[model samples]
Target: MTEVRVGDLAQGFLFRRQAVQLRTELSARGQELSTGRAADLTDRLSGDTARLAALDREVALAATLRRNQAQAANRSAAMQAALGRVQSATEPLATTLRSAAAGGLAGELAAAGSAARGAFEDTVGALNQSTAGRSLFAGAATTGPALAGADAMLDTLRAEIGAETEAAGVAQIVEDWFAPGGGFDSSGYLGADSPASPVPLGGGDQAALDIRADAPALRQVLAASALATLAADAALNLPEDTVRALFDTAAEGLGSAGPQLIGLRADLGAEEARIERAGARIEASAGGARRARASLIEVDGYEAATRMEALSQKLESLYAVTARLSRLTLLETIR
Candidate 1:
């Protein structure tokens, strides 16, 4: 046999390199065994990664859609709660005003005006609600509140009233102020001119949360409050009959608004259901994509386990050999 001598340094280096490779293979095989998926898809699938890439995109897209659904659900729920508050605040004011206007005294009617102011503030507060630091009713302009503060909004109305105490004039001013292209849109309401865009909830469905502070139902309630608020202004010093008539107007206006407010909440409830249904479909979509990806990358569990066991044994043997070699001194190796 031809003489062959390997230097101790070169032999040790090669053993170390082999041990490192065996450990790496052991780790990879262990992962495959546990996950039933190949650690190296490129090597396992003969370098074809197009299908895997597509599956990855599918999974990512599903995840994104789920996030969208969650956000839409949250926003709609917030809006629903706020709308409920508005309705709650509105119904009581109507009752209070009607009671005062029907058979009550001037003091009772004035008290009703105070109550209207409170309800107006409550409605404004409800509409200006924010979720996750973004305005719920601000349409596309979510950075700020949906409407100006109650006092500021009322101040705008006060300017429009401008000393008018006649029931018709006050009603007209309130109507025009909250009308389309009016002071409500231009000053009192601070949301975007356009409504918020619909949120995609997958399966070709969208969660359309377009309710804003400038909505007609909301305007009606606000106008009712504004009318009563003006009628009771001590500064105007109007007669009891005029104030009573204005209170009746405010009460009647708010009474008719109940159905519309209820309808708005019903609409949001429908969106909530739609989002939930879309959620189920989204989960199915992600599950389907995951299964497809798994089919491409999965290995036989038995085979994977066997490979892992073999790698583990090889690594142990290499470690034992390396440890034994380390015990051999340079003089011993040379000898």
Candidate 2:
């Protein structure tokens, strides 16, 4: 028979080493139990991190998409509000101009025209509004205001109209200037001609903020506003008939522009709904991805707790043995 002999010092050292190992395992198991995460991720994932990595990436991508979608929603909301402001700015002027024209009251028409000029300035401010430090109606040019100042635009219009006393000629020139590839495009609008790129809202969804200051609807409103301003200009010294003609044209333009601007608001509202749905989808997908990742990486809390209890007991036994060895005396050894 072969006998394996260990000295007291070496035996105690062995027990201490075993206790240290048990303590480390016990601590790891307790952490798993408390945190619900595997202390040994390499073991939990079987050393193949590709699936977990993919899930983590999905979570990150979803977060990014949600952020972008939120920003797009904000931009859309701002545009809707700005459009509403512009509509308010135009509607009252329409009523006023229509009334003045019907009554052929030159004094009332002039007062309304002056009011229209202020409203036009207000409209420009509304369209140039920014949200989150970005222009709401500037298309891709988020950094700058969407349109030139009202004064600048009126100056350009005045230059183009150039002492034209006829309402028909003034209207024609204003329309031409506000048309595509015209003076408004070159100077009045400071935004991009091309619309902004669609924001990705995850799950293959996209939302766009493409409404610009130079839109036809806005152009019509602004053109009408210019006519009203011209009508008010005592500097022009126009006849009552011509002023009435300008008032009628301006009123008509405002009347038609209301529907166009409303249509634009409806389109933006639709996009807002699309973004909201995409956000819901993104959150759902992200939740599923997170749960899937958790399934692989998270510890089974009951199992971890059980293992921790067993390890604790084993460590306690080791400490007891180590203590007994330390307390050994010559009489006790003999006994």
Off by over 4 Å in 1: 1-24, 31-36, 298-303, 314-335
What lDDT, from 0 to 1, does candidate 2 have?
A: 0.86
Query: Over the stretch 1-335, how does candidate 1's per-residue lDDT look in tens digits?
Result: 42335786788889989988988888898888888889999998789999999999999999999999889889888898899898888898888988998879867877988998888889999998899888999999989998889888777777778878677887888889888988888888899978899998777889899888888888898889878887887867777888888889889999898898888889889989999899899999999999999899999999988888888888889889889877876577799
The TM-scores of all predictions, comma-separated, are: 0.84, 0.92
lDDT string for model 2 (106-186, tens) is 669778888889879988999999999988888888899999999898888887878788879888888898888889998
In candidate 1, position 36 carries an lDDT of 81
292: Cα error in model 2, Å:
1.0
* Alpha-carbon RMSD of each model: 4.6, 3.1
Cα RMSD, model 2: 3.1
Where is model 2 more than 4 Å wrong at Cα? Answer: 1-6, 104-107, 300-303
Cα displacement (Å) at residue 194, model 1: 1.3
